[model samples]
Target: MPGATSPLPDLSRPDVGAALFSTWSVGTPERQRATVDALAASWNGRSWPTPELLSQNVYVGTDGDTLMHHSQWTSEEAYLTFVRAHRQARVDEIDAAVPGIERNGIANYRRYRGFDTRTEGDPRVPGCIVAIKADFDDPDPDLRRKWIDLVIEALETDPAPSPGLISADFHLIVSGARHLANNRVEVLNYAQWTSEEAYDAAIAADDPTPEWERVRHFPGFKGTTAKRYRFERSFVRP
Candidate 1:
């Protein structure tokens, strides 16, 4: 079967890299945006050792916390190296900037080997796809439609839409036991590409479009929360 982002890596090579997942909640909407901005800035200058898969969810419930984020890393050693080198410093910056963030929900990091998920191995320089899911609100129908158009325009504004992008199927995730399946929800991104370089280039394009500006200010944006998962195992088709 085909791999998630890119083609599976050759097992004959060295140790298959690791996949790290972290899940946490940011207290408020303002803090959520700030955290994402800060983390994005930190990722800018560093020579990222491995590719990453990123996804975010903002639940409407008020049980524990409403915001969460999910990010996948390339390898365990590489993730550990990055954490030892930058995690503490980044967290301090996050706390200082966004007072609402409490703590990383999962402290003990987890890793999943590549072999469990693919026939050969997971890709080394995988293309990344980022999706943000949100349940319907009073004003979400019109706003969600607008956001979808804006997103497509933003993507089209990029000149080279290939390379990392083998294909991008924007799924609605109609019915599932997933977070966004509650109501008139929307899953705004579904993409696949060849390499991380290609994906980055497509996103970091020279476009002055104000498409994303309006959505960023939308009321549905509670915060950019995430979760990290290790592939302990996966069921594949034969």
Candidate 2:
């Protein structure tokens, strides 16, 4: 986000510049479950350019009724260009899907920071996810470097907070635009583990690794909202 982090990963390449973060609110618990599952099925069937790098659909609900889509593209400019050419057909398809559901706004993110541990994306896999979103203090270069290094180290050390981690992806928002519903992120991270049993073992150990612990105490971030979602996962990566 802040001029890219030193040597970036494949996900951080310039061609991989645009990301879609969206939330859909389906009224009531009953409808929420059905609608989310239906939408996931419908989305998997839709015709559109393949998401260039990544695509994810996650469920997070205290009441068991929420869904979010995280998708990546070549760039914001690339996405804008494609939308201009396909806006009408896309709208028509969406209109048909719109029976009694309300569509929430979307946000575009320009920078991607991924910390690889296990594999990247697959919704069928079962895992425990730790998702954090917050506004960064826009620190000087030194602190930025420090933060990034800690994130990388956190997942690599043996005896990590959770063993058998699959992967971790941290994304930052360089664009100023964002969704209005309690969602504005200078940074967002998603970390996945192999299973709840694996995660429990990490926490049960005598000493836990310092990766996530250290980052949590860093002073450069504020207004952080952190959540843990069980059975949450990223959609199949393209």
**Top candidate when judged by TM-score against the true structure:** 2
RMSD of 2: 7.6
RMSD of 1: 15.2
Q: Clashes in model 2: which pairs?
A: 15-74, 118-166
- TM-score per candidate, in order? 0.32, 0.62
| Model 2 misplaced regions, further than 4 Å | 1-15, 36-46, 49-63, 82-104, 110-113, 119-126, 139-145, 158-161, 176-185, 196-214, 228-238
Expressed as tens digits, the lDDT of each residue in 1-238 for candidate 1 is: 2122223322222332322223446765455556656654444434443343121112111223333333333344455566677678757766676665654442111221111112255454333433334444534445555555555665566454444554333323223332221333544342334544665575577454465565556566443322211111121111
Whole-model lDDT, candidate 1? 0.40
Error of 1 at 123 (Å): 25
* Local error of candidate 2 at residue 147 (angstroms): 1.6
For lDDT, the strongest prediction is 2
lDDT of 2: 0.56
What lDDT tens digits, residue by residue, belong to model 2 across residues 1-238? Answer: 0111121123454556566666666667777666645545544555544455444445554345555656567666555665667545644554455446566766765444566544346443435565566666763535545675676776667553444566667765544443323344356666666666665676577464466778768777555675556543344543
